[model samples]
Target: MNAEPTTPTTRATDEHLLSIDALAAWIGVSPHTVRKWVTRGPATGLVPRMLRINGQIRFRPDDVRVWLDTKEIQ
Candidate 1:
């Protein structure tokens, strides 16, 4: 079995809207790293569409799933 974050998994609607901190927790990385990835572009070709609310970055849960599915093989 693949140990990658991209491995197929089920998503709960409640966990869909992932903040940068939430995303980092899911991916086992630091929030800073997640922010860097969001800015520098994902290791894969998928880029998260960021929303600025009160000057804070947020990511949609569905979008993250799509991004994971579309990741390019290294």
Candidate 2:
């Protein structure tokens, strides 16, 4: 009997990962701006919800949503 090759599995929760470009588009900013925001020190007042995996930066959709809510003016 031949066995099927197994493919690497990713958790369903990983679907929330957003690339820098995607996050920038969602927040109406350039990708370079997002990169700078994430890379700056905490004193710069940038959101702290970021993930760096395999040298690629990603953001969580839920975290971004929460950050936006916290930044509301009203």
In order of appearance, the predictions have TM-scores of 0.60, 0.71
Winner by lDDT = 2
Give the distance in Å from residue 10's predicted Cα in candidate 2 to where it truly belongs: 11
Q: RMSD in Å for candidate 1, one decimal?
A: 12.4
lDDT for each residue of candidate 2 in 1-74, tens digit (9 for 90 to 100): 75988776964565568998998898898988888887784346675478889999887888788888888898
Off by over 4 Å in 1: 1-16, 41-47, 72-74
Q: Write the per-residue lDDT of candidate 1 for residues 14-49, one digit (tens) a residue.
A: 654568998888767788888777777655453566
Task: Report the CA-based lDDT of candidate 2 relative to the real structure.
Answer: 0.80
- The collision pairs in model 2 are none
Give the range of the ten consecutive residues with the poorest summed lDDT in model 1. 41-50
The residue ranges of model 2 lying beyond 4 angstroms of the native Cα positions read 1-14, 41-43
Q: How many clashing residue pairs, candidate 2?
A: 0
